[model samples]
Every structure is written in C-alpha cells, then in structure tokens.
Target chain A: MLGIDDPWIWGVYLLCIFSTLLCLVYGLVNWNKEGEQEALEEKEEEAWEESEEEMQQKELGM
Target chain B: MNLLLLNIIILIYLLATLYLGYRGWKSTKDSEGYLVAGRKTHPYIMAMSYGATFISTSAIVGFGGNAGLFGMGLLWLTFLNIFVGIFIAFILYGKRTRKIGHNLNAMTFPELLGKRFDSRFIQYFSGIVIFLGMPLYASVVLIGAARFMETTLAIDFDVALLVYSVIIAAYVIWGGLRGVMYTDAMQGTIMFVGMVFLLFMTYSHLSGIVPAHQALTDMANLVPAKLAALGHAGWTAMPVLGSTWWWTLVSTIVLGVGIGVLAMPQLVVRFMTVKSNRELNRGVLIGGIFILMMTGVAFTVGALSNVYFMQKLGNISINVAAGNADSIIPIYINAATPEWFVYLFMLTLLAAAMSTSSSQFHTQGSAIGRDIYETLTHKKGGKSILVTRMGIIAAMIIAVTLGYILPENIIARGTAIFFGLCAAAFLPMYTSALYWKRATKAGAIAGLITGTAVTVFWYLFIHKAEAVPLGICKMLFGRDVLIASMPWPVVDPILVALPMAILATVIVSLMTKGPRDKHLAECFRGVK
Candidate 1:
C-alpha cells in the first residue's frame, strides 16, 4: 500500500491520517453537546470557590 | 534572496508579534489572567498554542534529520503523536484536568496535584524539580533559535542569543500566558502553511507520493555498511527488530517522546486554560490537524529527501549532509524549494523556536513563583503575578547563560532528557491524581521520589546515550555504562522508571490511607 512494502510503516501512515479524521469528527459531533454539563459545572465551581476563599481567610487569620 | 526584502519580512513578523503581546498585556487584569489566560481562552488559541509549543525546531530539524537517516519507520512516532498526544489527551485527560483544576482553584500543574492531595510538600517538590530541570531544556531551545539566526541572518551568535531572549522575555514576562498563546496561534498558522507547502513541493518534485516512495524503496540497497551493521534494512521498512537502530528508534525516540508528552507540565497547563469540555473538543480538531502537518510532513519529507538527494546529487541525505543529520532538512529545502519558500520556512523555524521557548519560560516561572515561593512562604494569590514576572526574568537569564556555556553535544540531548524525566517522575502521579481515587499523598510522594531517583540513576549509570557524555559512570565504575550489556544500555529510563513509579504509586496507595472522602468528592465533582 502507498508504495511501501512494510506493513509496520504503511500501517502507521494510514493510522495517522485515520486518527486525525477521528479527532475532527469527534470535535464536530460534540461541538455543542456539553451545554447541560457546563451549567452543572458552573454551580459546582461556585461552591468550590467559596470553600477555597474560606480556606484562604482561615490561613490569613492564623 | 534579497537582503532588504528579508529584513522587511522579518520586521513585519516581529512587529505583529509585539502587537499581540501588547494586546495580551492590556487584557491581563489579575493573577488568573496572567497564569492561565483567565481560564476563558478561545478553543482555537488554546489548541494552536498547545500544538505550537509541542513542536519545536529540534523536533523539525533534528528529528527530521533522524527520519532522513532512519526511514519511514519514524512515522510510528507521528501516529503516536496524533492518537496519544492529541486524541487520548484531550478526551481522557483534558476534560478531567480542566474540571478538577477549576474545582480546586488550581492555576498550575504542580498546584493542581498539591491542592488535590492537600500536600504543600508535593507542590513545592514538583516546583523545585521543574525549576531546576527545565533550564537545560530551555537553554537548548534558545541555542537552536540563535544558531538559526546566526546562519540565516548573518548575525553574531551572542547578539542573536541576547536579542531573541529579550524579545521572548518581554512578551512572556509582561503579557504572561495570554501573550504567549496569542503569539503562538499566529506562529502556529505560519508553521502550518510552511509545512503544508513543503509536503506538496516535495511530492511534486518527486512526481507524486506513490512514485516518490517507490523510488526510495527501490534504493534500499544503497544502505551504508556502518548503518546496516547497526540495523538498516531499508528506507521504506523498519530496521531489523531488536537491533540497535530499532531500539533507538522505537524505545528512545518513539515511546520516550510519545508517552512522555502526557506528563509535560507546559502542555498539561494548557488543559486548564479553556472554559469547558466543549472548547477542548473543538481544540482536538485543530490540534490533531496541526500536529499531523507538523510531524507528519517533517518525517515524510525527511524520509523522501533521500530520494531527492539520490536523484540530484547521486548520494544519500546523510552523505550530502556530511554525516550531520540535522543539516539534511535545511540542505534539502535550500536545494529543492524556490527562494520565496525559503523565507517562509525561516519564519516557520523562528515560530517553532519562539512558541516552544515561551511556554517553557511560562511553566518555569510559574513553578518558582506560584508553586514554590507561595507554598514555602505561606503566601497566597495577591503577590503571585508580580513574583511570577520576576521569576520569568530569572529563568530567562539562566537559560541565556546555559545557552552560552553548555557544550553542543550535551545541549542536543536536552529535549529527550527532560521528556524522559517528566514521564518517569510525573506521569504515574499525574495519572493517579486524575483517575485513581485511592491514591494517597504518601503514594504520590513515593512515586515522585522513586521515579526521579531511578531516572537520574539510569542517566548517570545505565543509559549509554546520556551516561557516556555525562561520564559519571565512567568516572566511578570505569565503564561507559554500569551495565555493559547490549539492549540494557540502549533501553530508555522511562521504560524502566515509569512502570516502577506506577507500582510505587499503586502499592503505596494501597498501604497508606487515601485522601478524605469530602476532598475527593470535591476534586471529582463534574470531572466525568
């Protein structure tokens, strides 16, 4: 295939191209699919930030 | 090429870079902005920055030269680069890292691990490792860029070194990661264009892809005697398995760099720059294509350059380069490409150097400022940006000094040494931190220390590539390597150290108490 006799070499060459297409397709497919998760993560982020701020305050007091 | 036209092109590019740096400076308002681009970076910028930082001049010229010497077998590295480096990295690691980093309010790679495990010791220890180990890598990159300038622009080496350092330092220190990434995106675009052009030109020059590869494959009998002894079967085929050439190509170059990239602090930090998994998903598209063009083109052109040389000069690439593999790519470009394309290629090299160096400086500075100093002094975020800027200056000075002082042979080994060390020391702990809830602080520390100790021991004693040049083994044991055995000396430290690190992490974690459930919940929140 592709004029190279070695399966190890040409197999890798084809796989590189194939994997790149996989990434492209994955990206396009999931482009807007994370909307609900983003909202949940935002709520979680707020709670975590509050805790981190409290920890910082306690350290400053010490 | 006309000197005046070249100067104008360079000036225009530099001015655009400075303008982007200035824009980054104007936008940076807080420590978050400086440290991780306010964690709201565009997917394109994040992906481009990551790709550009990952591929450097040495990756192009040096490894490309290796491809010229070795064969299409080097394409295995490219396969691993795209599949492992981009796909698995973004899908599996990036999402979790971004979520956990946000949850913990972590700003850097060391900080993320430290905060997760509630271990200041881990934070500062990792920081110290990075601050100390990264200068060698940074200096080598600095030297590559300066040498390119010295040859192409006819500037003195010292002047090139100073000017290049000052330009990168100005943007990186002042604008921080924002400046670095903004400039990186632009530079990465240039690199993409240049590489794509090179691939097309090389194929066209050889009449097309299939015919060109067939021509190279037909020339397999031209393998030099010395190379054949070491394991050179042909240009289109893998080296004889288990030979020195096979071991060096597969173990040291392919696996060492391929797997090692997962744990690189600079690359890992980019995962924290974006806002959500959606951005990372988009980034995967850009990053995969960018890396494909970069390494894929370099290795293919590198292997096929042998065909070009044989047709035009009646010699192989190594012979044409006078046995220096690093010169083969530049020589081929000069001989085969038109003059205008040479100018574009020069910009490509410049972009590659600056992009990689800026990320190194940023990671090093944060290691000292945010991770080391803050943890040690019990200081928090207020003074971090100021201290980080100062740390960037310090790192730049150290890199410049090393660039001036380090010998070329030792300098050439910098990237591999750093990559191998990072993989050995950090990969186990980093993976455990992300995935294994049972992993304990004690386990992390044990893995870290064991990994570091084993890798250092290997380099100083067992790994012939480094041990010979370092001479610690020769001085102490009176041998080139501690083990004068064949494949043992050729085996990379990561192959030995990473498994040990994983075992240490797993065994010690099982033996010790895990982190509190509440903290683990906090870390794992939204991680899936």
Candidate 2:
C-alpha cells in the first residue's frame, strides 16, 4: 500500500494477473496431452484391441 | 555453518546424471538414436525434457536476478514462455518439425536445415556457426552455476567451474541425447519441486503473500532517483518508453530471449524425439505447466528478492555487494533461506546447469559429428554414433577451455551472444522452412548472412548489446551519446540486424524463384 495507487503500476499488475489467469484457463483446457506418453498408451491399447479382434476372426474361421 | 552436507547433495546429483549417461551409451541403437533419443520418446519424457532443457539456471539465477534488479516488467517473458515458447512452438513448429525431421531422418539442427533445403552447404555452414558460437553460452551457463556454488559454498571459482563442466560433459559424452533427456527429466523434476518450495518459502519469509507483495510495491514506488528516472515505476510496473528502463525491458531481454527460444537447437531437437505429431500435441500442456512453474515462479521470486535485499541491506539491490548481478539470487538464497533449503536450491541450480550444459554439449557435438563430420569430411566412419561420441568429447574439451578463459559476468553475456547469433543465423531459415513455399536457397543464404552480420556488428558496437543493454541505451536522438559514453558496441544489434535479415530472405527468395522440392512445399500446404 504505497497509497498512490498509480494506474500505470496497477495496470501492469492487472495485466500480469489477467495473463496468468488466461494462461491458466488455456492451460487447463488444453491439459489433455503434451508429451507423447499418453498418446503412446492409447496407441498400445488400440493395437492390443486390433490383435484381439483378429484372434476372434481366426477363431470364427476355425 | 556446516558445508559437508551441501557437498554430498551436489555429488549425488552429479552421480545420478553420470549413471544416466552410461545407460544411454550402452543402449544407443545407432548414431541417430543416440543423438536424437530414438525419435520415440514418450510425450511425458519429451515434454519434461524439453521444458527442463529450456529452463536453465540462467533463467533462475541470471535473469531471475535481473527481474529483481530491473523490476517486475520482466514477467512479460514468462507470459511469452507459455504462449509462444510452448503453445505456438509445439503446435505451429513442433508438429511440422517432427514430421519433416522424421521423414528426412534428420537428427541434428543443421542436418534438418540441410535436408529440408537440399543444401549440404547450408548444413555445414550452420554447423560451423553453432559450434563456433555456442561456447560463449556453454561457458556462461557453466559460470552461472559455478557462481552460485562459489557464493553459497565459498569455493574457488576455477574449481567450481571445472568440476561442473567435467561432470556435465561426462554424462553428455557418455550418454548422448537419450542420456541428456533421461537426466533432463530428473533435473526438471528437481527444478519443478525446488521452485515450488522456494516460492512458498519466499512468501512465508515475507510474513504472507499480501505483506510480501505490499512490501515490493512500497519499495517500487520509492525507487531511487536514478532508477525512477529510468522508468522503474514499481515491482508490478512496466518501464516508461524512451526512458533508459523502457528499451532494456522491451527490446534487449524481451526480444533477445523471447524470440531467441525459437531458434535454440537443444530445445528444437526435443521436438524431433517423439513418434508422431499427436505425440507433439501431447507434450504442449505439460511443457506449458512446467514453464509456468519454472519461469513464472523464478520471475515472481526474483521480484520479491528486491524486498528481501532492501529489508536486509537497506537497499533495493545486493547485486553490487557481490560484484555481479547473477550473484543476487544465490546471496538471497543463503541469507533468506534455511541451510537445508540452500542445499535444495544448490541441487536445483546444479541440475539446471548440468542439464543445459549436457544438452548444449550434445548439440555442439552433433553439429560437428552428424552435420560436419559425416557430411563435409565424407569420412565413412565406422559408426555415426561413434563419431557423435567422439564429437561430444571434443566439444566438452573446448567448452572447458572457454569456461576457464571467460571474464566475470558470464551469464548475461553468454545468453546474448549465442542467442543473438542463433536469431540471426537460424530464425530466418526456420521461418522460411515452415511458412513459405517460395523460400529459396538464395533467400536462406541472404537471411543468414544479413542477420548474422547485422547482429554481430551491433553487439560488438551497440550499447544495448553489451552489459544490461535493456536500459536508456537505445540509440534515440542518435547513438552519438552512447558511442561517446562506451568504448564499443553502442547499440543493440537486434533492432538493425533482424529486419535486414528478413528483408534479404524475402527479396532473395522472390528473385530466385521457388525451391525445386515439391514435397518441401507440401509440408506447408493444406493449411490456411
């Protein structure tokens, strides 16, 4: 509380808070994937499923 | 004051990094895998490694100290870190870079340039630039961590510098890129945890969040006459334009590092490690969050340091007391934090220095091994991985020698020199490779030459290019005043050099017609 409450200084602070909040919002919304580990897990799951499907088809053919 | 515990913590951190390097060395499938991490890094590792590699001790020790000295205006860079550094870099650049890098099977920065443009000459030239120029940065980072060690532990500068360099270079030479990443992942963890704790401790030390910030504002509004005249309105204030403060805040630091991140080879190499574009898409959020924590916390704490120094020393800055701005954070650490916290911070800084140093060494080695040795010498080596390993050793040796030779104030000078060079040499080619189908070899060459020449000329002669170039050093009302005041480098080179490079690239590309590579153009096609 310097007591002046300078607009210019406070404006800078406001911008920082706004930007941080904005970054936080965007960051959370986009939190799903950023590193490939999550995607790799999904791909592995899909591959496992496809192999399982192929096994079923072969069993049916037999 | 017990010091043995601190020594043990640093040694343990060093041992872990060395172990990771040995593991990487033993498992490298070939040169490519060793150099580029097999291009199959899981997104989490990739993201953490990328963030870790970029968020060095320099960000924490050097520039964080600067924010404390300069005021809170430097926080703009933290915003840019998330938005541009992580988001735009990943989505806009990372996706395409990974796809093209994989398609071309390129493993190094210069290799990417050469393969993308079908120009080996470009590759070799870029390699030379990186190799010749990176030492300044490597040495500076070496110095940054060393200064912390020297100040906090009261060790000799040379011993600290040598020990840090040797430890980092060993991991990099032994482990290669995979080792760097695995180590980076760990270091990144240390940094994330350390900053989080440091942030809380800093706030607590101030008697609470509200009191801490209020103290900062009180100090800000009452900035010494010299600082006030230069536009240091407060901790939360931006510098006034044309004031000495404005140019420093807006131009040198803000531009030098903000855009410079795009051209950093070590960070760029991380983009190529993943298996797919989707993988790159995944690393974005993690990278952003890590950056927010690493950079955001550092800037916030750095700003808070002002209040601490003022309370303790009866002045806003303790920089002059330690004889270097980079020393501010360390002194603050020792004075304000508990001994255990000091050990943790030392570990965090050591992690930052080692992680970045190892990557810088690896990149330098790769530039020589993959980009130069294989391409230029045309030496059919026994194995490219072998060549890279050898190159890593060679680069480490050079870095060690330079680390010893450099004068004090290593961090700021180190960042500016390497980054300014990268901006000049790589930024144009990078922009062209991604966006413009018409970007020609001539354009790339023109841009490189113009940018490199201009940035160098300015830095050598510009005031802004020199020590704390952010302040009233702009060439307003003619640089004659500056030329008279300083010995050389009266203006910051970026303002003049960057435009010249862009203009040259566009003009040359237009004159030379489009590139012959249809597939190259297609990389940019199918988008808006």
Once fitted onto the true fold, the runs of candidate 2 whose alpha carbons sit more than 4 angstroms away are A1-62, B229-231, B319-323, B380-384, B464-491, B517-528
* lDDT (CA) per prediction: 0.88, 0.75
- The top-ranked prediction according to lDDT is 1
| Poorest lDDT segment (10 consecutive residues) of candidate 2 chain B | B480-489
Error of 2 at B252 (Å): 1.0
Q: Fnat for model 2?
A: 0.12
Q: After superposition, how far is residue B253 of candidate 1 from its true place, in Å?
A: 0.6
DockQ of 2: 0.09
The numbered model that scores best in TM-score is: 1
Q: In order, what is each prediction's RMSD in angstroms? A: 2.5, 7.3
